[model samples]
Target chain A: MTENEINHIFQTWLKQHKALLFKIVRSYAFNEEDRDDLFQEIAIQVWRSVTSFKQQSAVTTWLYRVALNTAIKWTAKERKHQDRHESIDVSQHIIESHQPPDDRLAWLYEEIAQLNEVDRSLTLLLLDGFSYKEMSKILGISESNVGVKINRIKKHLTTKSEKS
Target chain B: MEFKEMKKIWDTQNDEALYVINEDALHRRIKAKKMGTKSRTSFSEVLLIASNLCAGGVVIISHLLKNSGNVAALTMGAMMMFVGVYILFLRWQRIKRDQQTDVSILGDLENAIENINYRIKLSQSMIWFCLIVIALTMFTVLNSDQSVFNIVLISAFFIVGFIMSRWEHKRFNLGKKKQLLDLKEKLINEFEM
Candidate 1:
């Protein structure tokens, strides 16, 4: 595709999926700066991949795949770096957000944050209403495995919710 | 709760609360991207200018020495050696600066790759400059009767320099490939874990 066409497509995708990108970054990043960095990285990656986007999948699916992949990688690097030092103070920005909290949703997010990178992705996909098959395609996992993992994750979340 | 109930809550939640991405913010990002591109292009231009100046200076010096006769042979040889050493020093400094700036994993990899490609080109030009200076100095110092031996020696030196240059090119490519692969593996492991 031409540069202009790619830019148009990216602009449209960005406008439509801005909230999805924000949520993914918020879920995966440790702080506001990290979230913004991940967001830009995802945007650049998406722009790079725009030419190769065959119509085989929906644009939303492609966006989720790219965003989740970038977030996962970034979070892994941050975790490795964090091991050597005190973690950056991400909680301050989280507290300063003006949105009123939903206790249950906040609890759910806290639980999700505890998951390993891959499990976190699966849970996010499940929460977003993607089917096991769709999750497998996005994640490059077997459909059966997606089902099994989702079941395990849901049970784990249920136990955590009950305790809370 | 059932999956459907969770979906209902998720769907109803206000996405606008998550982010307020408007045209103004996107416009700012676009401006940043353009500025970044401009900076990179200008940096490459600077490198191109330096490389041309180095090559041009060497060629002019070589021509002047060749036209000045046998007495000028020693002076030309000394000048060529000095120029070669100076070029090598400049090349070393450039490589050191590039290494320091390009080591971070946070920056865009494609930009890094492009910068490395430019450096490789510069290195190739430097190698050619060295070879040309050495050859011209040899030609100036040797008598007309020694033409056959000088040709043989110059040919051998040229071959050796060419081989070394090719090896350096390969090393450059291998380093870039390894970096890109490491990046890919890191990303895949993070998402596939």
Candidate 2:
């Protein structure tokens, strides 16, 4: 795609689906500074992802893959640099201005943040209504494997929710 | 509060106007990000390669300008050129491999592991390069009329440089590689069972 075409698609995707992208960022990063750094990285990836947009999968799926992969790498890189102190761009929240208004949603994210990186991704996909087949495809695992993990996640979350 | 209820809460974000996109600010951010994400190693490698080629060129030209070419100088200069070309080729291959897009997260993770392995290999090659160059120069110095103190000082300097390079390798590459490997194992275990 041409540069103008890519720019247009990026803006359009951001306008339509910033919430989706922001969910991955929030799920992956915890610290305020780290969140901003990750947001910038994800936004950049989304912009660049425009060129490689094959129509085989939905745009949202492609975006999720790109954002989650970036988040994983960023998380690994950030953990390695424990003493990092670079200033971040926080002029505007870009995607969303305020925190989730609902206490329950906030609580859910906390529980998600407790899980390992891969399961955190599975939680997002499962919560967002992706099918087992889609999850398997996105994760490069078997549908049976996805089924098993989903059951486990649901069971674990239900037990935790009851305790809470 | 259950998983189903959590899904309902999450789906609310679908209609939530919690996001506001400022086109100009986003344009600026994207532009900035485009420039910033190139790996620092890539930049340093380019500088090191240039320095090697230039250093090699200077040594070759200076030695050749004399009545007779110094065999040791010619060998050292050619080795530098060879090392530079070797690094360039490795970097080019790596960049090419990195450009291949894999839509699956597992595939991407695998690619990341491979990239880190390549970095570790590159770092090891550099250490080897330093050792070889030092040995070549040391052999030349020993053959010539060099005093014992001067030889000891040069050997000490080379030893210090070697020690520092190993320290950097441990500090930067090995730890990160282990973390990624652990993450991969965790991910695999989560679903494989």
- Candidate achieving the largest TM-score: 2
* Chain B only, TM-score of each candidate: 0.39, 0.77
lDDT of 1 by residue, A65-99 (tens): 87887776666454443212422332223112446
lDDT of 2: 0.79
Task: Provide interface RMSD per model, one decimal.
Answer: 7.9, 2.7
Which sections of candidate 2 miss by over 4 Å?
A1-10, A30-34, A47-55, A73-83, A87-96, A158-164, B1-6, B19-37, B138-164
Residue range B1-193, candidate 1, lDDT tens digits: 5555555555544453645544454455544554443444235435545654565566557657667445444444455455556656655665565545421122334445556665666556656666665666566546455667777887787789678767866764556555555655653454442
Candidate 1, residue A70: lDDT:
74
TM-score of candidate 2 on Cα atoms, chains taken together: 0.80
Clashing pairs in 1: none
Question: Cα deviation in Å at residue B96, candidate 2?
Answer: 3.3
Give the count of colliding residue pairs in each prediction.
0, 0
Predictions in order: lDDT: 0.62, 0.79
Worst 10 residues of 1 chain A by lDDT: A87-96
Q: What is the TM-score of each candidate against the true structure?
A: 0.55, 0.80
Cα lDDT tens digits, model 2, A1-164, are: 68889888987888778888878887998765566667777888788778778789998888888888788777766465442333335576554456446788778889899988888889999998899988888888899999988898899888888898
